[model samples]
Target: MNQKLLMAIYFYPRGGSSQVVRYLYQRLEKKWSSALYSGSLGNKGLLTNAETFYRPLNVKSLDYTTAHTAWQKGTNPFDTENPMQASLEDRINVPDTLMARLSPEQLAKQIQSWRHLFSKELLEPALAHLHHLTPMHNAVYELWKKTKIITHLHGTELKMIEYIRSNPKLPFGDWWIEKMIENANMSNLIITVSPHDRDLALELLSVPKHKVITIPNGVDIEIFKPTTLPDKVKMSYWKHWLVTDPQGWKPNHNPGTIRYTENDLKEFYNDDGSCAPILLFVGRFTTFKRINVLLDAYSIFKSHSKQNAPLIIWGGFPGEWEGEHPYEFARKRSIDGVFFSGWRGHDDLPLGLTSSNIFVAPSVREPFGQTYLEAMACALPVIATSTGGPASFINTEPGKKTGWLVNPDDPYSLANALQEAVEDQNLRETAGQNARDYIERMYSWDNIAEQFTSTYQYVLSHK
Candidate 1:
């Protein structure tokens, strides 16, 4: 087996890309000796703390904790000794600079910082599995020219490149665009999270088709599998998340800005014995996520349906957003049922999914919906858009349908799907069962790992 060095320039469990790194490594360990070099932030115990999250593994991190502290101290975090890497998406306040916003000098700092990180590590792995396209790409090229590389695109980079290409005059647009292509060409193998993403890699990066391969992110069935939670226990969890120890954030504020009262818990369940069906949406509040659509649909669904259900909006990193905050959007519309759970660790996801009856996210162009699989594994009927990653796998056929795939960006379609899911509990139950079955048969981590193993071998031999 080939020795491997898995590298991602992001903190663990931040998003699906990070989750992919964790799950893939666990699966890869039996076949290869691997070391993880990831970007980390926060103190030792937090999820941003890489050593805590990727424990019991050989892990080294480029600590961004200092940069975070610098930001808190009202200094330029980007000018700190260990600067945070620029993000693909443009975000409001917080540490890291956006790639589009990065000046030539600032861009050089990012590459220099990553190079310093690479030099400090005693990494001698036979191959490097690098995640996302960044200044780290240039850093690697500068340090280890002969190192075998497998460049993994989690879909965000492609989206960023697309946005930059559309508006050609965007700052450093030409430079970054050409840089990504050069970075991609240097790789021996390119792995994408979905086939749709693979196509984008070919067109956007202008890399050869043979160089690009689609390997979808996997679901950890052991953790995400369905288990019916008792109402009292479910209510306790919801109370902790929504009322006590709340993390629900608002625009220009830290988490817990959108806390709920004890009386507000009534929306989670009806007066009758049966629990009020929870409509769950889990992801970052990026522009493409189209969370506004979910809020609109939820409002419409509540307006029509006598049986009310609360829409639990979960999972966005604190103080990071693309547009108007979801809380702000729901607030302006006087949306009553929508509740923000803020961002929680991966362990909370299974419980959240099992407690909710329907998993709804109307993302316009979701790269590959990792949360959808996690929700499916928990046996919840999912309502996703008809475009992008969800469209590729969400089968709505007569006997094999697992979830409802509505037209993207259309609130009414989502509202109708939401209505249908809540009303038809029997069909919902069947779909949930089907969703779990599909994940078990198709998207397990072990299966995805096998694909990576074979792909890795081919690259090694050719190189």
Candidate 2:
């Protein structure tokens, strides 16, 4: 048998791309033998992935020793044997006088700032810059000079933009593009998760088009399978009941509750024992996510339709961001159909997906949306914006296609799609089934992993 495909994924821990990185890790670990050789600011990426997936065996956090001078005196937080520690010690050699020149507090502050700055998102560009700026730090010039190890750049581009956006006068702006090119050359293979990103990487970084591969992100099909939901869930039906309440059901849902269990669900149903359809919005609660526009569209949709408004299962609760709550905004506007579900993880996400008639992704700038893929895999139809990464997958063929694509920023477009999806149950079910079939053929984790494995083999053989 061929040797195991030993690969290292260079990633940023808490950034937007971690979801995709974790998905890649989950898929690859199922088949080929793999380990996460992580470098981060505060080992944040490793910790974040750990919390999200919470799997520890495959992970190897490698914080650089020279990343902090204290490490030379033995106070580094990372494992001593980490690859980064070796590179750090070997590269950053301050003169004895120079080291003793600074006060302890000044030295500590400098190291602390450096430690905080190395996010996974920025690691690629920083590594790429270091490769050109100080050739001794280049992994390609050192470790890969003889070893047959394969290195892949996963979520670097997003961070480069962040660095550039935040620091215009960032060092090496003159050679930044060239350094990025060198880093791209260092990778045995580059697997970009979206078509738009693939194009952007090749164009901006000067990576050869043929060297980059675009693999649309995938979902865990087995885990996200549709469940047999009850015909009458005995939940409240206020918003959606106004339109299609043939059962003459009264509203039974209470918006103020910590958890809604089966007994509570039954008791919450109307006197006639029937409930209305629920709409769902799941993802991070942030401004770029466009939750405000969704509320506005929901208000408009409810006002126009004579049917009772649908109950919304909005996940992604906001932390103390000081921004006004979008649900509260909808409520103030007399939009009474939203039931916020806070944030649910892997196991509960599928059940939540199946519980809704439609999944709406209205992000104004979504880099890559794993939630859309998850929703589709759960046999739930989607109404996503026509821009961003989700645009690549949410094809708009109306009745036969997987789901509807709309202008995420436009209230009318979202309203139109929402109305279309809710008007006909057959349309919703058909799109939902098609979505499930599409996910199985294209976006299942097993298939994605196999594709990656093949890419690894090809890159190792050819490079």
**Which candidate leads the pack in lDDT?**
1
Backbone clash tally for model 1? Answer: 0
TM-score of each: 0.95, 0.67
- The candidate that wins on TM-score is 1
Cα deviation of 335, candidate 2, in Å: 4.3
Tell me the spans in candidate 2 whose CA falls farther than 4 Å from its real position. Answer: 1-27, 37-52, 62-156, 159-182, 231-273, 309-335, 396-399
Q: Each candidate's lDDT (Cα)?
A: 0.84, 0.54
Cα-lDDT of candidate 2: 0.54
RMSD per model, one decimal: 1.8, 10.6
The sequence of per-residue lDDT tens digits that candidate 1 reaches over residues 381-405 is: 8899888888877884568879999
Tens digits of per-residue lDDT, candidate 2, 1-463, equal: 3334333323324333445556667666666544344434343332434333435435544344344445456554232333222111111232111112223343344334333333232222211112111122244234324334332333334435434545556444334445446656665546666776666666666666677777766787888877657744313232222222211111122223323334423322334655445577876555667887888888788777654445454454223111455655655777655555544345556766776668887876465688888889888888888776788777634545888888768988898888888777798888889988878888887787787678666655663
**Candidate 1 off by > 4 Å:** 10-13, 120-123, 396-398
